[model samples]
Target: MRGPLVVLLCCMVALGACRREAPQTGPVDPSGDGQVTISGDDLVIADLNWTPPPVRIEEGAEGDARARAAEALGDDDLHATPASAIPLYLALSAISGEERAAAAGLRRARIRLLALGTMALDEADTGDSIAGLRAAHEFAAVARFLAADDPDVLTYLQRVDESDRLWELNRAAERALDAGELGEDGGGALAGFRQAAALRPGQPRAMQGLAAVESALIRRAEVAGSEGDFQTAARWLAHAAEVRPGMQTVVDARQRIQRMRATRIQRLRDEGVAALPKINGVAQARQRLAEILTIAEPGDPVARDLRQRIDRAVHYGDFRPGQVFTDALEGGARGPQMVVLPHGGFMMGALPGDADAEDNERPRHAVRFERGFAMGVREITVGEFRRFVETTGYQSRAVRRGFSMAYDERTGNFLRRSNVDWRSDYAGAPAADTLPVLHVSARDAQAYADWLSAQSGRRYRLPSEAEFEYAFRNGTSERYPWGEGTPPQGSGNMTGALDRSPSGRRWGNAFAGYGDGHWGPAPVGSFRPNPWGVHDLEGNVSEWMGDCWHATYRRAPADGSAWINPGCRDQVIRGGSWASSPAQTRASWRALAQVDTTNARIGFRVVRDL
Candidate 1:
């Protein structure tokens, strides 16, 4: 309200010289118009129904008044002050006409502003922090309006610098939590977050950092308890509780740890470990290990070994240890399932013992992924590709070319046919939209990726040659993903005994014993997924990769990144198509074709950065 400002102005004019000649008293307005009435030398505002003590200045009293005002504004809990004391201090400064008093008044205003701003950066209450920050800004404007030339105003502005420091501290905490370094020393992101919270209360990001750090610590404590290191586990869980008091995760973890004490954590650990080898899939093994860790003690050798095994399995694509998620495209119209891969090293090429290994698959060079990424759980199906086309009005290369290679039963091999494109099946019937879109060129695949990237606000592109092979092998050096022999039944849609139809007769060579129950491309994800939770890497259709075609790995990049030559016209293709033979279905098999090459046997999947 303007009542405070009006009172301030009236008091300043009246007290400039301590020349109060007479009492200008008026009726106390019951209407509450916030009218100020001067009674004797004291000032009163009717709305507040409050009166200030008469201003009486003695020799050298200005210093004492200024000091007292400073002490009041500098209280530890200035935020709880009933009302701002700025106007009273200003009246004192006017009556005393001392530069020190004026400066003190401004200093007090600045102190209050800083207090509000400090609360904005580190408060535990997210809503309060936001409101506090806004209030701090408003207070700053008022202080500036009161005295534009005061040096204390600049001193108060330094809080902005403190806010920046708080930001860095919060960010450090986030980085530490995300990296899983919960140590109390330099590695402790929780420590930094707490420090920031102490400096500026109620910051949302800082609170989030604390929650993540505490959760990680709780998980560690669970592991430690399982390993019989109750002391260490208790310490970590206590620390988590201290950082995020009353957090449900901390409460649950504590209860679990207590239960482990009664049941003897080792029993569960032993049971889980014994079940690991019997598990049919990596996901099952990971689940068993996770159960063991919940009661295992921190730093337990057995728990450590199990964790390493799970990590290796996940990296090799034999296990998907994390949750499967989806990314929306076309403004949430399409959500494609994806699997996360961890950063790791793997032998990218074929093994030396493989009899069917080609020369191009030689050198068995090492490849590493420095960062994790997400891959589509299956090849991009016609349904997905259709969305991209409909949204962007994109024309695939096959469509523009007016023809693409398709299986011709009469020719008993793939032949170029007019009017054949991604929309047409090999038999010239309308292709099922659920199947992997075929007759799309490498360029067309990249275009679709580009469209997806633009629509989803993520980097979506074809996987590199190494990424494809890594996912295809799925932690195995076997010729085929399933095993050294023929692929298991219903493993993929590869050309098999089932392709014996008139249309299947076109592919003269097929895996002799295998019958995937499909002659042409089966609907995406119709068969079992690879160990990495990806479907149809061995069949459905051969996928285009981002790498430029290379005859050998003589100079290929050691990192799992695409190796592209700007001038190259051919791109690499991996994962055999449904028309491929047993040897062609081998994981290490690689092929090169013109960038614009389109065929019913070729389709693609996509990769996104994590």
Candidate 2:
């Protein structure tokens, strides 16, 4: 067998050497193993004489008959051409008296025909293929019938059909490469190579085409990257992946781009952050953000961080919107915890569906904040108010008067009580540090705000009526801060019908099915806050606003500024208190009090301009 194959191979090589080669302008396959075609012919194919099977008309089991038939067929070497097996199968099929003998002959003939046809096409010479296929088909049709519907035979035929298509696809890709159409508009190489590879795994020509295209893509990406067109470079590498996914060069290239983006993003962030403290820092920072956005991936941490910084630039100092922080006082002491409200706009009066809207609350017009401001996280707590009084040696208007309104838990009524000042609780008892301060007149509240401004070097003042309502609304246009329907349990210290006073007395009208566990003011921060993260904007107590008393919003300032009538005796108040009725808890509810009128139900929160 070795002697015949060696002699045949030597003859074919000699024949191939004598033939003239055509000059190809197209790029040759980089892999020498690609486009393999066996250079041989039928004369070069070797075969051996076989001893024919003995006549066996055994009327026995089908397996026994097939076993005898296979014994006669002997060892069928797949590597050798099936030429000699054809004569033996023909003679056996001719002598068949049983179906088993005829079937066995047909199976052997099918195998020989399939092998001959496949081997013929393996050579580059069309003459050899035509002659070889013609002999195999003529032998099968005239000498014996083949089982054409057999799975193995059908699969081999289908593969033969697909090879023609794959050959064309791979050739087109190589031609595209030679034409310098490696995806630069005269395109098709990448798509062609990728399609051929996917359609036929391990096809040598397709694999070679893909490898060549991938190399070209890598070179193109390198050129673009060297020119500092990183985005364009990345685009090339992405195409390389489509041609041959997970190519190490492409993987490494993408990682390099990510690192470059990270480094650039970091540098931009540093520059933008540095510029934030300068006079025109925000303007400078915005420019950096635009560039980073182009290169940075979506939801990049550095990009998100830069954006947050820019947003916070419009807030007080370094504080972000909805963030709570405390400003430092003169002696390194921190002031009230202030929550930054984002600069935005909102309707400043009663909501549309609110049937209880008052005349003064009509004309719900838009009030916009041109800039952001920070408000005390809660109404000035008793301890915080005490700090102001102690620092300035201030005598509150109520203290000067030596009397203020105080609640009587027994009668559930408010009455004037002597010695009831900022230091007093609702019942004029000694207040806890955590409790919200009350019984301080509007003038007294102003003094504390003025003192805070002087101490912290920030503009601390009472919020205007509009600002107060807007802040508490926290981006909602609903009538209640907690939304429509019954308030959730522990929403705030607002009045509830189920709540009992120290005397076991319940309110005639309050939020039904809701109890905040308090009949009077609870300690500040005891209740759940509004959505803005500010505590006790409602329910703890009604609050004093900077605006003077007005009958309506007819001539109101649309900019959210206080509508002040200098020397006005009356001041406006907003929000609901623990003892407030259900109707009083409506978001737009407001009332007036004499500037000198200090009350157990009213307190004030400060806002600092950003």
Candidate 3:
């Protein structure tokens, strides 16, 4: 008896009672075969520390019962044949008064009970658990009656306790998982499962529980990312990875964050544009762009375009129409005083039924200023040009060519004169610094504008022809800059009938009974400014425009952009000078001259982007 029991216990130990197997369900045998089997949940725990129930051997059955039980237990498949062996083991425990025989029965029943109940997790198998429990209860009572202190008996008791712990862990894990206690929040299904796996690693129940928790976390991450909450998405994915590192689902979920950026940025842009045109529109739009750049990839065209529009909006918001300002230059000097113009639309050619209308002013069309810019409040002054020339030592076209068109006062006509430059006024004489600079080529004006740009870190350029006309009209489509009939007292310094030259010569065709104080160009801003708060736009020297000469208003730009081809020799000139006749001062008048042409009647002002 000891030999078979010893061999069985050795096998159980070597197989490691702590090692868990994947579930392999074997069918239960319902037939008890008249054996006294244990019945309810009560017996599972009640009999673990059993006491003896007065082992009085039956009077004449000890020898025969012992022989039959030993015969049943001798079979190698005794654990599976619990229906046959459990009854025999019980019979022997009762028939024989020997504690050794009872111990043998307890050992057989323990192995048999585990074989039946280890995987018998179904509640429907009350009969199987009862049979194992019944055998253990009866046999363990008698077996421990005298052998309670025996090493083998004590060892068997310890194994039964371990089995109970494993069962409890699995049940707790299952319940926690069903209750949505996934471990991202801590102290949930993951804790129970980890303990169970540590006790019996790679067990099916614990591994499945861990997988469930991981899957739930990944789903949460996906939901957050879809709604553009990438921060939350990243947090959840990180938690999922921590829960189970190297999980493919978490890795795939993390990749989706980058893919969602396109939709997110476009939505923000739409919101920003919609909010624009309000009082705080630019501020709101700027905030939206900041968020966009955080997620947008470098060089994204949509992001770049949004930034540019916002910058333009900022300029629009920062200034008001008719506002005056000046930029600081490098040496503490200031650029020309400038006045801001309002954005507007206007008819761009001659008015109907006006006698001064030329063919070039026909074919009227609409022109619009979508954004406002700052224009010089007055024509470029002689003092300003002297600073540029003295600073850069630049050679004007008149200086290089040694001659330019000037007022030949003796003949009462303009003619080429040597030594005439920007310093000389209309009469070919050195003039006061306050006078509008003259004898400057269009190229020279451009150079001065370039120098101002570099000094002030701003863009300074000649006005486009459309811009000049827009300022000339100042939002009114009048026949003349000052509107029809004889000129007002000091409307502009055009040729007048009462005007007298220094040599006592008077105009043959001029405004009747109208005379400015001096015959030649008046000092800049000497006359009242137009409605736009800009002086000398049409009355000072005619200003150089940035466009090349186009014979008519045909195919002109409606957006107020310069309609110029680079290197075109004949550049446009606009407005009226002191020598201009009444017809020349009409709002629709335009003319062109060679790029290198320099004359006393042509000077320039500048316009800068806001």
Q: Residues 98-210, candidate 2: write the lDDT tens digits.
A: 45565656577457545544553342122223233223333223222344567766665555545455555655666677565776343577677667768776655556666
Root-mean-square deviation (CA) per prediction: 26.5, 14.2, 15.2
Local accuracy of candidate 1 as per-residue lDDT tens digits, 11-36 = 32232433323322222233312122
lDDT of each: 0.68, 0.71, 0.71
Supply the TM-score for candidate 1: 0.49
**Model 3, position 501: C-alpha lDDT score:** 88
Clash pairs of candidate 3? 38-130
Query: Lowest summed-lDDT stretch of 10 residues in model 2?
Result: 40-49
- TM-score ranking, high to low: 2, 3, 1
lDDT for residue 597 in candidate 3, whole number 0-100: 89
Q: Candidate 2: how many backbone clashes?
A: 0
Shift of residue 170 alpha carbon in model 3, Å: 50
TM of each candidate vs. truth: 0.49, 0.60, 0.51
